[model samples]
Target: MTTEKLFPVNGVELCAETFGDPGDPAVLLIHGGTASMLWWDAAFCAKLAGYGRYVIRYDQRDTGRSTTYPVGEPPYAMSDLATDAVGLLDALGVERAHVVAQSMSGGIGLIIGVDHAPRVASLTFVSTSPGGDDLPPPAGGLPHISTPDWGDPTAVEEYVVRSIEAESAGVFDEEAARALVRADMARAANYEAVMTNHYSMNFDEPKGGSFGELTMPVLVVHGDQDPYFPPAHAEALQDAVPDGRLVLIKGAGHGIPEPLWDEFLAALAEHTESS
Candidate 1:
């Protein structure tokens, strides 16, 4: 896998990494809130690469080795995030790509599908809520988040790992969890910048027109036991997109399970190839 590097886009730089040959089909992976692209396991990316897919996973503006501004709230809107994705594709000279994202990134994917339809091939949403008021609110709602000391970067990092461990519970692999935490924390630019982006951005509204307009294949994968967004959220997404389908994993939570990685990868491969 290629290491993370800064790509200039929209007057800022986004940190991104790549795998597989450039000649293959493209799959762009977007991570969740406060999470770097590291959340998408390297082994999973390698699996896609082996399948003749050119996979690209990248950090959002504030979360990883990308641009960060600690002094104030983020000036960019959710649309800007969507623009960043398309911009990244442009930077790579990719005309179109399959967008695969998790959690908040899923909402962003929907935006891209709606506003920049020509640039997207297909969409895969994992453990995420649907955009817009057409569907009922997500089941179980969003889980309550505990704030850590924003001034102390170490505390912020610890909180991130601890929170993931708590939510993951039974399905989590200790070694893998630690490795991801190390990758994310080591590369995080600033906790204040993360907080700024998190609080300032609007996640509920569908700023990129209607998801119904996306005629391409859409896939929603969610865990039956997801604390943040329940299975019904996946159902909502499926309902919203005419060509969308849902996959409800058993015994999994908000995070993907290590043992079930094969199942997740298999489904993703099938969906990608179908598009």
Candidate 2:
């Protein structure tokens, strides 16, 4: 995309970035829980653009530079989040686009595929499960990290520590990752607390039946080292979604690390093309 802007949709303004030419086929990239579009990373977006795609990534509400619900619960359901994505496309004058949603955001993509199929060309889920709010937890409980208050000097360090624990082999650049998280935190309000709510928020049962009903192509990407939603979750989704395929990244975790970025990028490009 040639420009980045704050586009209003669904009663709020979303901070969106575009790469490559608009006339090219569009691919909307939705980041994971509590993450801004920055998680998609500049290099990653450029690579997708090199594939001749108009890649659009945005900061979802309550994260990044987008609208925030600083107090209490957000006044929306999981499906409403999906509606926001469709509304964004409508605002941007995009008739249809492929969707690559990661983690909890993928739940929104699933809803869009079911409820707003005409707006989506294909669906790709990364590190997520179709089970939505009710997926089983891993054997080990989530690590207990003391998240510092938002904007505290120690906040960046906290972010890095948690990330190091999540990435399979700690292959990422520590200083760069810290800087990114720090910037994202400043753009957000009450970042850590807000994310806690986002992750734990309950959802009503999904309206559609199993994912097998979706007619469009689907792809499931999971990291073998992902401790959050394991490889089995990806396999299950692949089996459930009709005409779906799965790819497992050998050294990746729930988060995309530098080492697996190339493989992930290539696989995603191929998946979108075939779809």
Candidate 3:
């Protein structure tokens, strides 16, 4: 993978990994809540590259190798995160690219696609819901195993290890699971700003105007058994966007990097190509 260094809107330095030729069509991938760019698995990235597209994945601010916020006030907002995405593209001299996002990052990508239309060739939302007063939070609260204090390294590491072991028992390959767990641990060590950003985005009421402004093709992918954002949430988002399609993956849950990787990549490729 090729690496590029970027400075975002808030002056946070970030690292982005690139696959495929630079001249190929580009797809920018935004990962879900508490996840770094490494959440996008190597297999999926390779598949996209094999499709002859330039795939770019970055650690959002406060995650992975990106710069983190100091101990003072948090600069966390959906708008700020969305702006960082655009700024990354600008820094890379990319005029336009298809945007693919999962979980909380879906909202960020939507904001960018609607507000900065020219910069987005298409929008793909995976395992996410559009934010609004009517939207429901995750049912039964989040899984105990999934919840971790963003500021606590020990808790985060323990959470990662437990989550991976629990979720990947007989499903995910052992090596892949271990790598993902390690990546999650690394991300959690620097997660204060990203978690703050997530909370800020969650509590803020959706204006409801930005989504309708999206003219590019939109694709929503959700697992049939997703515990976090249920399938209904994906349906709601599909109804909200003018041009949206929903694809449901059976026997899959909230996470997309493992069992649903192939389906996710296929849907992404189809959407990007059609758009």
- 105-193, model 1: which lDDT tens digit per residue? 77688888888888888998888876456544443534455777777766776676667866663687666677777677677777667
- Model 1 lDDT-worst window of ten: 134-143
**lDDT to native, each model:** 0.78, 0.78, 0.74
RMSD of 2: 2.7
Native-referenced Cα lDDT, model 1: 0.78
lDDT (Cα, tens digit) per residue for candidate 3, span 1-275:
33645555457787787888878888999987657787887668878988878888888876777776653345667767787889888877788999998887777887788778888999988888876667766656444766677567767656666665443323545576666766656554455554444554433322435677789989988877676666788889899889789989876666564666778778888888732
lDDT of 3 at 270: 82
Q: TM-score for each prediction?
A: 0.89, 0.90, 0.84
How big is the RMSD of model 3? Answer: 3.4
Candidate scoring better on TM-score of 1 and 3: 1
Those runs of model 1 whose alpha carbons end farther than 4 Å from true positions after fitting are 131-145, 204-208
Superposed on all Cα atoms, model 1 deviates from the true structure by an RMSD in Å of: 2.7
TM-score order of candidates, top first = 2, 1, 3
Clashing pairs in 2: 1-18, 1-19, 1-20
Taking all chains together, the TM-score of candidate 1 against the true structure is 0.89
